[model samples]
Target: MGAGDDAGKSFVTSGFTGTGGASAQPPSPSPPVAPGKVEGPLKSITPTEISKRHILSKIKRGTPSDVKNTVILPHVDAEADLAAIKNNQGKWLGGNKYEVNGRIWGLEGSGAIYPVRGDGLVEMNKLQYEALKGLITHEGDRDAMAKDKRFSRYKFHTTDEDWNVAQGVYDQR
Candidate 1:
């Protein structure tokens, strides 16, 4: 064909060979994904969810620096503590308190005794757990936490199951 004739001819490449064709070949298939997992467009997330996730992610295991004012005690036996709280089998420490693995945990309505480590690993009743999650759902934003001068510095803890359940409840609400 003449040089001028090639001007209107649109060529499509096929794979790595770079062979020109009238139409492009079908794209290669993607690798397999894990079981029971879908890879596609993500569900829309709200700003509140994002903020809550960010704040929750920031919380680390163990007590925060300023533990004097908070009820979360230094972790002695986290697993045991969690189990004790879950089973309610800890030794009574008086004043509506329980002790397990050297950690003193308080009952649900005994003042501000949130028996949780910094990373959201909590050992409390359903009501107290919900209330704690509600706080995270509300003021869980980094900017908001920073801006609010009186915001509590204590990073409370919650279990994975609890977090997911709480998030689901919040989503429903």
Candidate 2:
């Protein structure tokens, strides 16, 4: 054959022959390594995974009565609940009212109203606050909350602050 004949043909051979040698061909893929034998018997492990989106990281744990408080609720809409309290739609467990960042907010006993910027309260950064604000005003979220059983106790747009306020209210009681 002519020199040009090998141009399109592979002269790849095995071993370190020199130009146009076996090394020209791609190396064969090595077989996957088998997993090493596990030492001892496999232990039963419990999974502790939870969704960061749904669960509030700032939820309160301890109660005032020296017990574990688990009645924390997510913050769905503080404005709506506060409005409800003002409109006499819901009872306001009023106690101390606070003006934080020029906004009046408080946590009521029994979690009647979510508190703002206080102990056991979820502190919101600007981004989190804005995100929650959008979520709280979503029409779909409102509709779901009205009809969904899950939303009956907790709103669809809950935040860590909401959970913390609920716990704080429970703690106050």
Candidate 3:
């Protein structure tokens, strides 16, 4: 069709030869599936972390409800990044680059955040973890959160067997 072709309900040629329909063709390349493992206990985020968030919340603005986290584990040169972070700080600038979805979102305030390093997923678990931390007012809230729809689908890999038990109904015949 020409550029003038009006938008409509449509499909694609997919560039595959002799297709009876789109159904018979293989889907695009995909990430490999990870092997399954037995579930583990509901690992607590820690009492101290909850307290920290509570204090920070009183002083800071954003609440748990207002945020959704995306963990970005750093996947690059630890030493060089740390040096960059330090150099950036000496000059007063942005932090080291952390790759997420293959893009490096640099830090805004500081030059470097060299706490954790090497083959790790930088910032990946941070925001969500902090949000979870902010939500832990007491023990019971944690229990309710297990059944929380917003968080249930995102079963922490740490919560092995418990996650399976909690998630079992959907898979049943």
Which number leads on lDDT? 1
Residues 105-146, candidate 2: write the lDDT tens digits. 433333333334322233433323333333343322435434
lDDT sort, best first: 1, 2, 3
**Which is superior by lDDT, 1 or 3?**
1
**TM-scores vs. true structure, each candidate:** 0.25, 0.17, 0.24
**lDDT of each prediction vs. the true structure?**
0.32, 0.30, 0.27
Give the lowest summed-lDDT range of ten residues in model 1: 42-51
Candidate that would win on TM-score: 1
In order of listing, the candidates' clash counts read: 4, 2, 17
In Å, residue 112's CA in model 1 sits off its true spot by: 10
Kindly report which residue stretches of model 2 are placed more than 4 angstroms away from their true locations once superposed.
1-57, 60-75, 91-173
Candidate numbers sorted by TM-score from highest down: 1, 3, 2
What's the CA RMSD for each of the models? Answer: 26.4, 30.5, 19.9
Candidate 3, residue 71: lDDT:
22
